[model samples]
Target: MPRIPLKYMLLPLGMALSACDKGLEEINRNPNASESVSPEFLLSSVLINTAYDYQREAYWEEPASAGRYITLVRNEDNDKFDWGPRGWDSYYARLSANREMMEIAGTMNQPEYIAVGKVLEAFNFAYITDLYGDIPYSEALLSKNEGIVHPRYDRQQDIYPALLNTLKEANNELSLLSRTVDATADPMYKGDALKWRKLANSLRLRMLLRISKNYAPAFSVMQEILNEPLKYPVFENNEDNAEIGYPGDIGVNSWPGGPLANAFAEFDKRKPSKEIVDALAERDDPRMEVWIAPVDDPNGGRMYMDDYVGVPNAIPAPYDYNGGSPHISRLSPMFNSNSHPMLKASLMTYTELCFILAEAVQAGRVTVAGKTAESLYYEAIRSSMRYYNVEGVADIRDYYNLPGVQYDGTREQLITQKWIALFLKGPEGWFDHRRTGFPQFTLGPLAASAVIPKRFIFPDTERAYNEKQYQQALVQFGEDRAGTLMWYLK
Candidate 1:
């Protein structure tokens, strides 16, 4: 599969809307996720919309920013640079939407709906809780009709199991599906159920491994995928990438297209950190040109600066990297002029899979008998390079036979590359960095979160609406702010 469509593999890429135009107007007693069922169809709508929603706000935006950040200021968001504001209401809203969608699926007999919904919901929750800490999951949405209006928060440690199980069940249901309504409403896969199944398993692999250091159970899960590659095939190329579609039609396109009225307004939003630049540079990675745009150095040839750190998080005016300084967080070649970080987003990539497996072998988690992890590691390196369609680079196939090769045995070797692999993919890098503390990134003088934030703070909106419950969760993580540590981080 192609690493990315280099297009909007739009999140919620499952269906086309309009069939269920009423939307939750009539929650079916037993809905089928395909066809005209409002609840089922909304699954795609809800999720695909989220990718857009995330781009529009910081909570969703922050996962990537947080993963990449050392320090920075939000020209538009005082809450971001301030390190407070209940963290991200955007995630909360997304989660609430997910819960409602899933609840509808559950009320109905839509097997695929429950299956996929669980995984997508888990995917969303991972970002939320990981960014914030203890959130109202177990007790959330009770006000709809339930008794407890103030549900206590669930710990992040507890949340991981659900993330795993959700994916596991998703894969299982997908494996046995008789047929799904052409997924006419689906945008992600263009109605392809088989592909969604692969994505489900792929996601399971990622989630299990995400909490690997903390969850001893991850060992078996990893082993299962290795044992059954055929049963759980992962995206082999960029084309199979879990991506969101970009409209590119001005406001309807992505955030980078126009002036975002956010805190990063005066500043350009999201640029490649010196971390990304230097890593690719040191490795002689050819994709640097593709990854970053040259600064306006009238000389024509780009100049490398000495900061060793990086420039302001953004500089966006005059319709270019014109306000540019350093690698303004670069845009994918797929993007035209608007470079909004939200213009397009990735859920996972084949490159990331290669990196994870490479690390797994390098770490002795997956033994390839006599073969050292060197090849896998190199394969990962090359596969990642290939993803950007750089002009030239060696392919992974060559590494299998190369001699004098050695596994990047150091943790740094595994993580640094992993971080790079994760760019535009998922915030997995940010989570990984928080868990393992790699790169020991240097922060800019004005960066927010000072260090990469481990979790997103609860939304201040919760304080007003779900105040009591929010406070109770605050106690679980030891802080009310998004930065609080959850079960595993502690």
Candidate 2:
């Protein structure tokens, strides 16, 4: 009965414990899988996915067609506005990741990540509400925490204010300069808290201007932000634009229609719409060279005032329009490349901010001390030229002097330029068209819908699975069709 070693004495007990149910449960867990993920890890994934998805949506046919920027010559369903119930699965998936990131950041006491998360959340939700009208907001992405599988659809009117408040909260949190964010995790601003703050306020201004028509207080809140510059900073120049560049890593990371990712025919089918091509060509805008390619006349039999020609949207047999593909302008050759400095995924730009401010001033919403609508209008156009890297190629002043390009002090003039500046940025073009009715887009003879669709139909899956809530939501919408106007529009 000599003293036994402690290890040997516990060996039998340890073996017995391992064989028991409690120890077996622990032993069976996967060694490779993580029980938790860091906020930085989630931030990286969220940024990449959000940017990639948004860029693809912006550059692709759907929004571009609706915006009258480009038209598809083949598979022209979207061009015809033959939209069905469009699902928002990808938007919600990104939102779920963002929610998880924000939660983890809160537990870790990282206010900066939480602030960034708020901005991202607002951006995603804004797109949803803007596109589809009433959407699951307050109760969304809460399946794990509260098991709310069938979240109620929040009215667009209600959702807008909440989004504005969220951005305000983010701006306040980001003002705490002491807190830091991982630069590598942030692709848009690279851990620039001030830039994040700018984006929050800038986006707030955008939303406020959007709802100013219906919401009485929107302009007042917008005035408050503009009046307090330091407390609520906004994008001052192109340097502060919230945009992300593609790594051109081929496969998934490359530009959507980049030569490496898509076949030649796929890229060739998307011809610049006559609406945008004529707009650019008329003003001798240098951006046309950056955005549109000159049409090809191999036989030299076609006489053209400008080398560029565009296909009309919503028309039958668009592929054969303007003497087929050979005689119509395709997108600029630079677009076909895997990546270009000029082609980055834009969340928002100072160019857009300039136009927003101009519109606000024109509409008597807010006023700056030394600026007028005309001045901001000119700045907007100049910024667009610089953003497209065409400023050096041609003087902006000359283009501005052109008859139609000059500042006419009309809302139409202001928004039409904003529309041109917003090309391929996101759904902003379509959103603006829906909101302002600028550029006066006309439906073609062969258009499917008589009226320009205001919102997307609710996804069919919601009807199938979330029947009760879905039915309740339909009462507010009246009909689950694209022609139905959302609260914002109403």
Candidate 3:
């Protein structure tokens, strides 16, 4: 369990080009490739490769640019608020792999592989829809026989319900699995069907809770999970966390930015944002120390008021803060160094589930959850501290005494704390900030507009390749601008 073999992990995690190779043959399905590879083997490849991409792109890159935890000292386009184009093209590649896995599983009559494919496909589509709003879903991954080269977009309103059902179906199948792949094939849960079932339900909870504002059925689902927690099987502790382990020996699996990306390098221009530093400092949260290192002033001492001084977001290059140059605090060694190869790529965690429950309670969506919102909020805080390897329960307890940190049974309180806990994990913090509008962020000095971006622009390829469908979607969503609101956001 400690050292997953290289077969389970990978040097270049997403090196498999079967999907691309098949596509080049002018069809989605390749008879030769499908016959050569077992569905169980393809399942392993899709799971690891998708997890690796999620860790690199979604976990580190997207959230870093989103201005929640880290800020760029280079002060380029993303920092300046001219958010770049984000098409689902790369994600579609993963989805293509997933569809092939499911198809193969069906032909082979391996229910376990089929169930795993459903779960992974659900995971990818949820991420895709969340980021892009309406996207090609029902008709996607059908370009081979259906001749759906330009599939129409599925509204977020329609997509969530379908995704929830898909997750539910996957959970049912996983629970009934009498046999599964080898432990190596299931690196995340080591072929534990129960754990896989838990992850499926937990992810369903996450999706339901996210769209609960517009979708009222979420309350009943939450209540069902609460009334039968054992039956539902959500993440109970850090042990059930959906994290990917890195081998640290290879380029793809190694930490994002590698060894020299540590605090020692001159060109390592990333720093924690001042917003996060001030928030953690205000509550005397010990995780602040775990996140970043103190800056070394030229006078041979740390001249900062706070131990770590974060760079301001969206500021122009050569930006000055507090009359000092941009020698702001760098990320902690634990986060950036290659030495910590086992650095868990967090997909979801027990802490996040707790906060979701806390928010649901605060919203009065579910009254029979046993524990109140306040109690779950505290548990969420404690779990986050422990997950980050923060020492001393007393420090966490002391944080609770602070007016800013105390649970006030308010949505603001729940989301603000949840936002803090989600720091540097992924775009969840930024996404929650958008949904609840809590933990309000200040616009960087070079903001693109008065308001923050809502959604990323559709990629140029979509416009060029799928112009008819792409234009139709743009008109439906009301002009694919950053300011345009998605259905969920509305």
Candidate 4:
């Protein structure tokens, strides 16, 4: 399998179907080929690679911590300084590549293969739609096949339900199969069908809660999944985190790694925001010390909240901080020695599961007899402690005192902690912030080309090629305010 790059995620539509748009079209061209090749093989190949890109940004917490990045730019006390591509072009490429596998799966009677394909589609679509508002979904990628030149944008409400349904469909289809088939083609799990099934359920839970704001219907399913663990059992620990490990390619590592490592990062890119550092500092959050190191400001270079924050992304630094900054890279144990990010970013974790469970338990959704939100809260914290390898905090008094470390009676308190706990897990923290309006962040402004960025705009290529649908979708989006929320969010 070819290694995926952090800069460009997926293949384009033109490249997706150089020979034929659909699987059957290829067989139609050469009918005599018994088609010894199975759709599962093709799907395993494409899906695993796609997982690589999604996993990359997640591990480094690059874009999600943009909130931190923005703060860093402004010399604020609570953010960091890292930046990655933030637009629809990359996602469009990735989804295009991913959708081809979906088409291949559709032609076969292989339930397992189809289910797995749908699961991947659901995950990819969720990421795309969450990042950019109205995308080409209901009518996308089938121009030559259906002569449908212009596909309309599907409402996000409709998109969300479909994403969940596909996951459910995957679970239903996979459960019917009694035999264990090897899918070594899938480099991530090596074709373990059971893990795929669990992945589907776990992914379903993720999508279900993602729309907690606009849709009240998910509330029911969220409760249902929590109640019926047997029917919808999900990843319960770090072992079950949906991640893809890089095969130690110097240029292939996710963050601060490989050929790009020594050049792409200047050791100044990974500073910890006082907000995050302080929050952890209060708990004496073990991961903080593990992930960051203090800078040597021989001249008291710059300090605040008893800590230091990096300059904004793309801002030229005077020097590279001597390869020592209170950054994740400082925590060498989490990665192999390379200046770039790791490819093995955890998409979700046991800590996230426990946090959700804690929230559910508190809300009376899990049917716990007497579990209070506070109890669930502690469990969430504890799971985070274990997840980050932060052990033996004999004192909770100090943690309970800090502003960030304290648990206020607001939704912000609950989610902010969980968000910080999920570093390097993807832009989920941003997503949660958008959905819940938690933690009281000030979007303000960043570089001349950037803003708080409420949502990503549709790619220019997509508008050029799929003009009809793009024009129609344009009605919902205004010229300015890329950060504006979409219909579902509105």
TM-score against native, each model? 0.76, 0.93, 0.89, 0.78
lDDT per residue as tens, model 1, 291-408: 5555434333234443232343322331232234442344333333444332355676777776677667767776543445566666666666666565254333343233322343
Best by lDDT: 2
Poorest stretch of ten by lDDT in candidate 1: 1-10
**Model 2 alpha-carbon miss at residue 362, Å:** 1.1
Superposed Cα deviation of residue 304, candidate 3 (Å): 5.2
What clash pairs does model 3 have?
A: none
For each candidate in the order shown, give its overall lDDT on alpha carbons: 0.58, 0.83, 0.73, 0.57
Better of 1 and 4 by lDDT: 1
Model 2 earns a TM-score of 0.93
After TM-score superposition, the amount by which residue 192's alpha carbon in candidate 3 deviates from its true location, in angstroms, is: 1.0
Clashes of each: 50, 0, 0, 19
By lDDT, the better pick of 1 and 2 is: 2
Task: Arrange candidates, best TM-score first.
Answer: 2, 3, 4, 1
How close to the true structure is residue 111 of candidate 2, measured as C-alpha lDDT?
A: 74
Off by over 4 Å in 4: 1-41, 58-62, 69-89, 102-109, 180-183, 253-267, 297-343, 360-372, 393-409, 442-451, 477-480
Q: Once model 3 is optimally superposed onto the true structure by TM-score, how far is the C-alpha of residue 349 displaced, in angstroms?
A: 0.8
